[model samples]
Target: MQTKSFAALAIVALGQFIAGASANSGYAGSCTNIQIYPPDGNTNYWKIAADCKNNAGQTNLNTKINIDSCFSNSNGALVAQLNGSFHSSCTNIILTGTVLSASCRNTGGANVNTSIDTNNVIGNADGALYCFNQGNL
Candidate 1:
């Protein structure tokens, strides 16, 4: 009788402990914001700044930054001329284009990722004019 009660209580306690552990198991990192600006008079040259929450246990930083110049046609999408993964400490970066889009991911532990969609720009230039900045990472 007493033995059976002890066994039941132990099982209940184990179950509660497991549930509590699972509730707290996940990645809790995020990027605050991504800012883009033209470095020179040329709109084709852009600089990017991204702020991230450097949560503990985070190892790698993966980023996909892009620029999309809106044109009259459907082929005016410009990707990041140069983008890749690095240490989480590498926050400041550069992306060149008239429009901007970006994604930042923290990996190697719990996983947290965020992205920014491409922005559209309207002007009196031909669709081909925007192609000057179109390229891949």
Candidate 2:
């Protein structure tokens, strides 16, 4: 009887150990940071910068920049979206958006294609950048 009891306790302890190991197996989610630069210089263009980190166990990580609108004049419009993907940690990511024309009537635009200027690192997860217009028309 004592041997049987000892065996049962050992099994329970083993089960608990396995459960704890699985709980702390891998990185659970992702982290993303974004910075926006206003329209400037001769080109009158805006830019969005992003940084992302993907913990282990994550997959199909995607990063994006979403432009709401650019309203100044007839030539004003916004780039719809800019995006990038990663499988791990990264830094100093540069994503360029469309140029804002110096026209009043050409205002408002949506997600535009993005160019990945620099991808310092790679990991697994999803991330994005959102640009919303909050200026008066």
* lDDT (tens digit, per residue) of candidate 2 on 77-114: 21222221121112222333322222112224522222
13-118: candidate 1 lDDT, tens digit per residue: 9998656433322112233244555434544434333333343523323221223222111122222221321212122333333233223333333223222223
The estimated TM-scores of all candidates read 0.24, 0.23
RMSD (CA, angstroms), candidate 1 = 19.7
lDDT of 1 at 80: 22
Model 2 residue runs over 4 Å out of place are: 28-137
Worst 10 residues of 2 by lDDT: 82-91
Model number with the top TM-score = 1
